[model samples]
Target: MQVMKFDMCYICLACFCIYVSGCERSNNRQIAGEVEGERIYLDEVDGMITNSLYEYLFAISETRIIAANELINLKVLKIEAGSRRISVDSLLSMEMRRISMQETKLKYIRDNALQGGVVDERNPFKLHPLDTPAGAEILNNSYQKFLRIRLVDELRVKYRARILLSRPQPPQVDLTNVTSHARGNLKALHSVTIVSDFDCPVCREAYPELSKLFERYSDHVRFEAISLSSSVTPPILFAECAAKQQKFWEVYGYLYGQKGYDFNIDSLIAQFELNREECKSCLESRDQHKIIETDMNRLRQVGIEVTPTVLIDHRVYHGPLTDKAIGRFLDDLFKETPNPGN
Candidate 1:
């Protein structure tokens, strides 16, 4: 039986170990090439390993990783023997570039390890899709690989040894206190809030799915719709003012269900006589500006750069809503303990 000796360094790095003829120096000397298993076959001084491959190894080291692919004449750097003493940049141009490449790789891996997976052209740094068996398997494998290489003990401690890249849970909505929304006492548990501009076509597309989600989960979720048009009609203002009069959800339905602009605030403003000055003042206040800014910040923080930005719990969903995305959010949310009094 041929027994395989465990070369700890390469095994730890998950590199294929290779044994080559006439190269057995194991102490503190510099060697460079594609390192398979125990093999140290050298490459030309100018041989380049792309930054994508180098950063994975660099992530394990103490230095910051820098991309060497853009640098001129880059090479792979490796530590030889056990001595930390190595030549400075002026002494070995190729060696310096290699060290730089190693540092680059290490930094890249360390940063992404915190994110639970590496971002590459292929994976695109997104939350791994787990809708299918193949996708689920891939996500699981990536998470496992992330945990294996990451050196941060605290992260490993907090993650329960499992890597997850989803947003944190959102607080539960209070269905019983629905009247409070009309009373102008609005508070969101999260620092960032989302105020949807309902007139947006993309928002129109999202409304139904959002409505369904709100119906199922309104007890803990709080989303507000604010119209951006300067013109007001009776139906529009009536619906909004009635909400303050403890009739928000009902008016919301009436206003949104209407097929046309016949429901604009200007059309219903005189009918409701809802103190136009107060309503207009509320809509135009710097406070409203602050609210929109808060929403924008929340979207940006979570990397939602486009509209139809739906803040479901703590997760930010971009583009128009999808049943699949909503399902995923619900699935993830239920996995946690429901909030008290939700």
Candidate 2:
């Protein structure tokens, strides 16, 4: 929730208006400015900022503000690159190609296996059922991903190549006192803890991937799912009640795989073959609310600010909960140690 100061924002707005006025006066021609004999154009900055804003639905003033900031930053970077005898445009094009290829590969898989006529059963990423609102949701998410990739490509070229920012330090979270509903071996060498909300769509999307990882690496990795909020407390408590009957996974899957958040606990109990009397008693006890509160407090202590934040061995990852990304993270962790079974 950080924001620039009002005066600073006002200055940015003034600069933007001046730049736009310059462009209009020049008959909407490309060149907006020059940096150390190198030409900086309005179109290039527009392209970068426009692509960045594609995924967002902001007000016109807000969009202009963002575009102005991006344009200013890009001009500074271009000047720096010129000083270093480097071509910013060339670097950006190369990075864009790299990002484009990676995105293309992911989309190809999604199209062929998930969205196309034939469903590939072996594909790890689950596709939302067609003819459903969830399907449209997933499609919109994919489009956003493409737009983000474009923004990332431009930013990486500007910052990463020049080492403008240092690598971010991971959050220091103490996991010793945390309790988790877990699968896989407790004594396993590596631990994967997911602090997530059952009500969160992203967390629900990550569920199957984590399940697959647990299944695949049960011997080597301990997998824990800690419920992080009261937002989905009812379903979570229902799952806890099912856990009392040793049917947690079944209930967990049923809840997440359902079309929407409106859950019927009694119906779920019958569907999952849980003992009705015991589950009803457990639900009525209200003890699971305390458990959820404890988890949320623990997350807050560790500066967790998002749903579906993951801690794989001690490294934290936030959002973009794709199977491939998680797999790569796990692979990096695995590479640092001897075989877990050893």
Q: Which has the greatest lDDT?
A: 2
Cα lDDT tens digits for candidate 1, 1-342: 111222343254444212211233344433664455554434322122322222333332211112222121122111211133554333244433444454453464465463343233375655543455645566555554443233223223433443133342222222221112321113433211233443556656666776676556555545554333323433434445555545556666555655555645654545555666766665556654454445445444334344454444434433236655565445545555444454
Model 2 Cα shift for residue 39 (angstroms): 50
Candidate 2 lDDT over 173-201, as tens digits, reads 67666667778778877777887777888
Q: What's the TM-score of every candidate structure?
A: 0.35, 0.50
The per-candidate count of clashes, in order, stands at: 41, 0
List where candidate 1 sits over 4 angstroms from the true fold. Answer: 1-195, 220-255, 270-273, 280-305, 318-320
Determine which window of 10 residues in candidate 2 has minimal summed lDDT.
51-60
Clashing pairs in 2: none
Highest TM-score: give the candidate number. Answer: 2
